[model samples]
Target: MDTTGWLATQRDDGETVGYLEPLSGDYSLVQARNLLGHPVGGPTEFLEAEELLIDRGISELAERWSLRDAPEELDGGVVILEASPDGIVVAHADLAKAGVYGRRVHVPWPDVDLLLSRETPAARET
Candidate 1:
């Protein structure tokens, strides 16, 4: 149930958000709920997003940095991030962005590598 992974992502600035989650296995966007400390629903790239967080430590990274609320488009990814040594503040939303008022998943840097969305982010960027 508990494990670790990684998501090597390049920010809009071309910076790296590496080493994020500690949850192992590739989960769907719904499984992202596990790493994100939240729940996810349909049409969301849960597994894809989860893997990236696991690999990049994007969730634990958020614990160390102050992040801006990237546009709440509710796409299938982490939209906002502020940099830190541990990782980066990864802001993710479901496809519909349909959780709460914010609908954002905050993954602490250390645990991001464990997320399920790793490959999706890679394919997206490439």
Candidate 2:
């Protein structure tokens, strides 16, 4: 398989990241997310936006709305990544909604963006 072409997401199966050590490869959906926002250390979950759109989420008793049942117009984007340190980043148009407290990714102190990505350990690199 052309590992270089795969996105950071496709490269990961809950363990290893699609790591190209040279860092010359173009950005995929996942790499783009990593570059544009906060860092996502190690393995993480990658969910299609449509998948989440269909799930029923909790809301006030007086208010009930199903992401799946919402009008077609409500659904957008190809994917949503739950990255480490960055939380839930809704990526679209090369932009993501970061700074949300929805999730967490272990980062290098306050300056996460500067942390370099290394190949995960053999045991964890699935």
Candidate 3:
């Protein structure tokens, strides 16, 4: 029997790639690549990396934003703390009331660029 609850797909650079396939338990790292749209590595390598991300509670959808860890919402605005070859780390809180926790999630460079393009006031530097 198929225990499919949800399916999540996304276009990273441009190609439509599979992100989450609950029925097959696949978090596809093969879908995440440089702008050129080439597979990052062999299928086995991609699978291993995908597994590690999921084990850390970073769902396939979350991985697009490079969320390698479980999210913890905080009380503040979105701030880009760091950027590296791997990804950009963003500290952001939900738009809830004050006195709440913020979330620190790692987003890949591509996604980071996309977010920065939005240019929200809260994300502005002080």
The candidate that wins on TM-score is 3
As for TM-score, the candidate ahead, 1 or 2, is: 1
2 or 3: which has the higher TM-score?
A: 3
lDDT of each: 0.39, 0.28, 0.37
**TM-score, one value per model:** 0.24, 0.16, 0.27
- Report the Cα RMSD per candidate: 13.6, 17.7, 13.7
Tens digits of per-residue lDDT, candidate 1, 78-108, equal 5334444433345443322343334445445
Error of 2 at 46 (Å): 21
* lDDT by residue (tens digit), candidate 2, 15-105: 3222211224332123222322323332223343212212312111112111222234322321233333333232221123433323222
Q: Which TM-score value belongs to model 2?
A: 0.16
Lowest lDDT sum, 10 consecutive residues, model 3, at 58-67
Candidate 1 RMSD computed on C-alpha atoms after optimal superposition onto the true structure = 13.6
* Residue 37 displacement in candidate 2 (angstroms): 19
Write model 3 residue lDDT over 14-55, tens digit each, in one string: 333333323234543233232211233344344553443344
Off by over 4 Å in 1: 1-75, 85-87, 92-102, 119-126
